[model samples]
Target: MENDTICAISTPIGTGGISIVRMSGSNALAIAFKIFSSKNVSQESIKPRYFYLGNIHTADVNEKCMMVYFKAPYSYTGEDLVEFQCHGGVLVTQKVLQSLIESGARIAQGGEFTKRAFVNGKLSLDEAEGVIDVINAESESELKASYGLLKGNLHKEVEKLQNIITDILSEINVTFDFPENDDEEVTSADVLEKLTRAQKTLDHIIKTSTTGLKLKTGTKVVIVGKPNVGKSSVMNAMLGTDRAIVTSIQGTTRDVLEETYIYKGVKFNLIDTAGLHDSNDLVESIGINKAKEILKNADIVLFVVDGSQELDNFDKDIIKLLNDKKVIVVVNKCDLKQKINSSILPHAEHMECSALENKGITEIKDKIYNMVIDEKVLSQNVIITNIRHAEALSKSNEIILRVITDLQAGANLELVSLNLQSAWETLGLITGVSGTEEIIANIFSKFCVGK
Candidate 1:
């Protein structure tokens, strides 16, 4: 199966300038040569690193294309590769790909290109996961983190930690074999110190993942306040577009309008909901109910207050609802003479902004980033951005921690060795040195076809 040739459409399936039909395996170039017709270059005459202009004649149509070849080990999949840059029409590309598939090239699965990259030692599990992240990134911050991962930033950190763990395990094994030498040179306290340091490092990485995951996935920011308090206006400013309907009439926005945007390397999902006001209208009531539900799951509540109006009883109700949730008080309509008292809200950070005038929005973004991602955490940070890497690292840490606890509680040396070996195996799974067939399939399934 590893030696089987694979082919698929690399570009998106739609009208565009061009589309790519990619093939990989030992005979990628041969399969491509079978379908291409070029007067200037023959399949046998084409070199390993040349592009030949050609015509792809299918059963129905003739498609103009460019054929490029990459010989084994230097290619993306670490095998002989060929790419057909053909017309962008969906039908034409499919016909060309199908023609190649019929010529001894099997259709590549979703992410098969990258899967081969992993199997052939072109990338680690973390780096492979980053390829997916780069394709799926929705914001600037996410793309930066994904780029870092793809470049092996997270892999280096994980490998370094694994090396430290390996050293500790070696020491443990040496102590177990030579009791007198262990007593003369190193004590159990030395082992405890090493384990404690490793545990702290793991804890730090876990903490960094909290922020990294948020940046990748985005923070759920819900805008809540009384009706006519400019919640929709604020949403418009934050999104830099008017996605939500805004009018002078109260309850103009009777539904939850969500828009995601990037600010200073952080992604936020700004949710503008129906104004938090008592209503009998069924539709408005449904929207209000949804607003409350969204608030429950939100990472931050942007309580937008109408600065030109006095604080009403409903404003107090909103404050009561956010008893435990992270709240950011936004005094909207600050361009007008202020009427609401900021001192009333205790311990909540207040920012004056005019969503209408596009004033002070940057301040709001800055505060959100600071509150969610602490400066201290970023000081010693190498975050596992992918869900798979985080899960694997966490499991490895758990196994090692369990071993340490058992040893501290007077467990046998062999018991500690078993757990230590298990931890190493868990870490190996992250890099595909030890992984199940199902896990590989599951990871690849998330990729775009012909990735």
Candidate 2:
């Protein structure tokens, strides 16, 4: 099955300047030469790693295109590969792919090329996942983290830890063979010291996931306030566009409005819900219910309040709903004579902003970034952005901790070795050294078709 040639439209399926149909495997070059023809190039004379101007012949159409060949062991899949850059159109690209299939190439599955790269040892599982992350990144921060993984930073760290574990296992084996020799025996203190060092490394890596997750999935910022308090205005200012309708009428926004914006390389998913106020209208009441629901799950709540008005029951009710939440008190319309007192909400950070004038918006953005992300994590070369890697590392850490506990308890050497080996194997899963086929399949399945 691995020897079969595979092909797909690598570029997005749409009208563009060019569309690329990619192929890989032992027969990629042979299959490409079967359909491509040019005045100066032939199947027998085509050079590797060079593009040839040609025409791709299909059953229904013939189109001028550029054909490139990559020899095995040098291509993305680490196999013989070819790409046809044809005129960008849905029908043209499909016809090109169809021609390849008809010429004995199979359609590549989602992420098949990258999967082949993984199988061929060109990239580790996490690095392959990082390729997908780069493709799907929504913010600069996400891209930076993904690029770090793609460049093998995490792989190097994991490899280091695995090496330490392998050494410890070897030591344990020696201790097991010469139980009577005090010089060869692996003491509990030695194992503890080594495992403790590994544990510290794991702990720092795990800590980066907090910021990684936020980068992968933007921080959910829910804006809530009483009617006509400029919640929509604040949202517009943050997004630099009018995403929600702004009106003087109370309850104008009866449904949740959501938008995304990037600030300082971080993505913020802003959700503007109906004003939190007493209402008899059925639709408005339903919107209020949804607002409450979204508030409970929000990463940060922008509790917008009209600075021109004193604190009211509506504001008090909304504040109560924010119990124990990471709240940012947004005193909107600060350009007006201040009436709302800031001392009332001491639990949350207060930012005075005039949304109408776009005043203090940058300060609010800075505050949100500081409140959620640690600056140090962003500067680190390796961060765990994928939840799978984080979970695997967490499991490995747990096993190592248990091994440490067992060693401290004076457990048998064999028992400690068993736990240590388990930890080593668990770490291998992140790099695909010991991962199951099902796990590998699931991870690649998340990738876009033709990746």
lDDT of each: 0.83, 0.91
Q: Model 2, which residues run further than 4 Å from truth?
A: 180-182
The sequence of per-residue lDDT tens digits that candidate 2 reaches over residues 1-451 is: 9779999999998999999999999988878878888998887888888889988876787899899888889989999999888999999899888888999999988999999999999999999999999999989999999999999999999999999999999999998887788888788899899999999999999999999889998999999999999999999999998888999999988899999999889998999999988899999999999999999889999999999999989999888888899989999998999997646577899989999999999999999999889889999998888889999999999999998888888998788888888898999999999979999999999987788
User: In candidate 1, where is summed lDDT lowest over 10 consecutive residues?
Assistant: 374-383
lDDT of 1 by residue, 1-451 (tens): 8889999999999999999989999888777777788998986888877888888876876888898888889988898999989889999988988898788999988999999999899998778988999999887667877888788877776677678767767777777677678454444566567777877877778767888778777889999998989999988988888888889998888888888888876788899999888888999999999999999999998998999988889998888888888888999998999897646567778899999999999889889888887555444436666677788889988987887788788776666667777777788777776789898889889998899
Best by the lDDT measure: 2
What does candidate 2 score in Cα RMSD to the true structure?
Answer: 1.4
Please, what is the TM-score per model?
0.91, 0.97
lDDT (Cα, 0-100) at 438 in candidate 1: 90
Query: What range of 10 consecutive residues in model 2 has the weakest lDDT sum?
Result: 340-349
lDDT of 1 at 360: 98
Clashing pairs in 2: none
